[model samples]
Target: MIKKIIFTGGGSSGHVAVNLALIPHLLEQHWSVQYIGSEQGIERKLISGLEDVRYFSISTGKLRRYFDWNNFKDPFKVLKGISQAYRIIRKEKPDIIFSKGGFVSVPVVLAGWLNKVPVIIHESDITPGLANKISSIFATEICTTFPETTQYFRSKHTRYVGAIVRDELKDGEAAKGLTYCGFTRNKPIILIMGGSLGSKKINEMVWMNLEALLVHFQIVHICGKDQVNHSIHMHGYKQFEYINDELADVMAMADMVVSRAGSNSIFEFLTLRKPMLLIPLSKAVSRGDQILNAKSFKAQGFCEFLEEEELESERFVDMILGLYEKRSDYIINMKKMNADHSTSKLIDLIKVYT
Candidate 1:
């Protein structure tokens, strides 16, 4: 019998990224695929371009860390979402469900359990997010990007599968990257990625030190949505709200990267052997997962990290230059690490569970 799979995840691109990487491969193998995401999420926008994968939208609420009046309303929304997901899963009769651990997946995982279908949850951080923590009990298997994460789950079902990077990111050409950016080979390129939504403080720092930074390196800044400053267009600096198709080429030409410490992004940087300076989100705003992710990479000699709280207190430009000087050492450490065939491994696991 042909196998059909239901994929759920996404409040951000990170949650949906693994599903995106896996879906194309499954399609080639003639496995039927479908996605369950929020109606107006970034996932829907990202997945809309793909062919043959049917997309389903369901109600979802943000899993917040702080107080909000919506907190009371969200549970009801989640209950509604569970009903919606249960109905869909019952009708589709998928052999398996893959969740990347977002609020939307909570309902889907619960619904899958109600229908007696196997559900696999992929957690990218060292610690489980709120959504994954809630979904874990119902999950048949849990996949992790960090080996240390398995300690949190006593279940033998939890497997340490390394990071899943998109295949196309590895195919970038430096020449094409330079041509696209109108940059010369005379200087090193630094790519600043603040995440999908962008970082205000990072952008401000970049603008404040633009002249000093340009003296040493060419720069491409993916400054997040509506974060671009069109007023200042210098010879060596390029700023965009976001780049889709050209991101691979940008990665190809980037000698070093200044980015937020999100698991998927860091792993992609590691796979490309790009030296990185990671600035994790602060504990006040998040659950401190990025801080832990950064610490792990620092321990492994993969990158240098600065806490968001230290951005103002530290000599930011000096830190960037220091990282540039020691870039080769970081690359060496990264190269010494074994690379896992994560995408293939996950596919194998899915087949086993199915």
Candidate 2:
């Protein structure tokens, strides 16, 4: 029996959110759960007071593909993380290790492989992250969000599990969300999220053109924690520093969403069958994985993409209007795309491997 499982990943909301979704499923089966992640990452705060889960600190850091001073420090950091992971794994003696794919997950995964514990990795993006790519060799199963991801991994071990989204997103009603956001049932609602850390560019663009957007639609802007006050003033927009347990309500209520192309947000948009306008980060060093994630869904007609470079006030407004005009097409495509039940499939796979 799989008595215990160790989840490894952290550095972004994308990594932490998967674990949050999986926790209830694991508990339903009476499996003891523990988390191994960077002490400084968002996971620490998100899981700080969780029950029946042990959290271990690891000294992990990202290795930039570019030449940089930070790259020089990564080797030492990874080594330290590996040592900490080694100690934690030896002590926990977990039967299975589940990794959600981040640099922070590498050390614990390596330790699990060395200890002969089976490791399962879930890649949430259309493109796999560096940690998932390297860890694939040691992973017993490679679960992916999209079918296209199989081409990147060693063929036999990979499976398309779709994206595992929070149960709240799957269970909520759009009407409830609309009411919470104070929107009239007949009004077209627009939801804008810049990601967990917030996007300065997206915020600025919306601020500059707030009046125009308000003319046609009511907006619920999750401006991230830092920009809440400024974002509220910038457009007199209804803003939340963070939505807490209300994300699903907000998502369901919106007629459309404008968001950064982060894997987690994109998958959430798809899960809700919400039409979206994507603004991918243009910076080179950030991995800009969002661009690839957005392009993949766009190809399937599930959502529309707007490159950050091309995102002007006119273009942004035009895309929103276009989505409204062709709303039925977007809804049909979203339903087709949402046909896959990724979370339940993933839980079943874990049962098999365990």
Candidate 3:
């Protein structure tokens, strides 16, 4: 029988990143890989371009923390999603299902469980996301990025596999990166990443303080798809809608990073030993995962955390400068976090479970 596995994750880049790390390894092992996600989700867009992995989209519904009219309609959509996912799993007969916590993965996990497929779910945040919390019961094993997170679980199935950083990111050329951004090595480059959908507040903060920022650092901003302001033109500032194949080179040229506190993104920064200024999403909007992730990184001396509400142009500019001044100190601490970068351990665990 051919070895086969199904991967499910979506909603945000964090949820989908671990799956991306595993896809190449699975292909190398000669396993047939399939992905299940919502039709319009980020995962479908990111994973569909890969030729080896078969992509399958099903009905999906968002799980909300606040009351919305969609709440009533979403449960029915979830049921429909579960049905569609169940049919796909039954037909594909994947040997295993790997889920990276997201709202879309919940139905997929449940469907895999119903089909008697073994499931493994990886949680990137300090706490389990709402989707992962719901899907945990169906998972045969639960992997976590934060060791502290295992305490909340029953302990038997919990494993600390660390973060999975992509292999392609390790070998970026500074010249290629600089060339791609039309930047020179005369000034230090500061890369700002605001997640998949983009952070409006971060964009505003950067633009508001653009002149101050340009004086000290060359800027390469990943502003999300269609989020760029074509109106702004500056010699030292480069804004891109999004990046894929060129992300490594762009990041390779960066002297420092300013980013959101999504666990996957932060961990990648740590792996690269890049000095980072993190602005986590407010508790009002998210479950405070980013806030806690940022706090942990700060406590470990890996990065500095600035609250979104406290983001003033002057203060934000100061924070970036402060991070730049202490860049070496941050890189030293990040070097000590070197153990988390390896995918071999995660790949081994998946094989044992497979």
Tens digit of per-residue lDDT, candidate 3, span 1-354: 568999999998888999999899889989999999999988988997799999999999999878999999999999999999999999999989999978999999999999999899999999888898889888899899999999867648988888888888878888999999999988999999899888888998899999988998899999987889999999999999888889989888999999999999998888888999999999989899899999999999999999998988878988899999999999999888657444788777777866
- Stronger candidate by lDDT (1 vs 2): 1
CA lDDT scores, all candidates in order: 0.92, 0.82, 0.90
Please give the lDDT score for candidate 1: 0.92
What residue pairs are clashing in model 2? Answer: 174-252, 177-249
TM-score of each candidate structure, all chains considered together:
0.97, 0.92, 0.98
All candidates: CA RMSD (Å): 1.3, 2.2, 1.2
The prediction achieving the highest TM-score against the true structure is: 3
Query: Across residues 257-291, which tens digit of lDDT does each residue of candidate 1 receive?
Result: 99999999999999999999999998988899999
The collision pairs in model 1 are none
The TM-score, computed over Cα atoms with residue i paired to residue i, of candidate 3 is 0.98
lDDT score, candidate 2, position 121: 94
Which parts of model 3 are misplaced by more than 4 Å? 340-342
Decoy 2 TM-score against native: 0.92
lDDT of 2 by residue, 1-354 (tens): 658899988887788889889988888889999999898887877777577788888999785567788888888999899889988898889888999978999888888898888899998887788888888988989988777878888749888877778886777777777667766766688999888778888888887778898888888888876787552543325888677677877787788899988888887887788888888888553676788888887898978899888988888888988988887898898887536677788877777766
lDDT of 3 at 165: 85
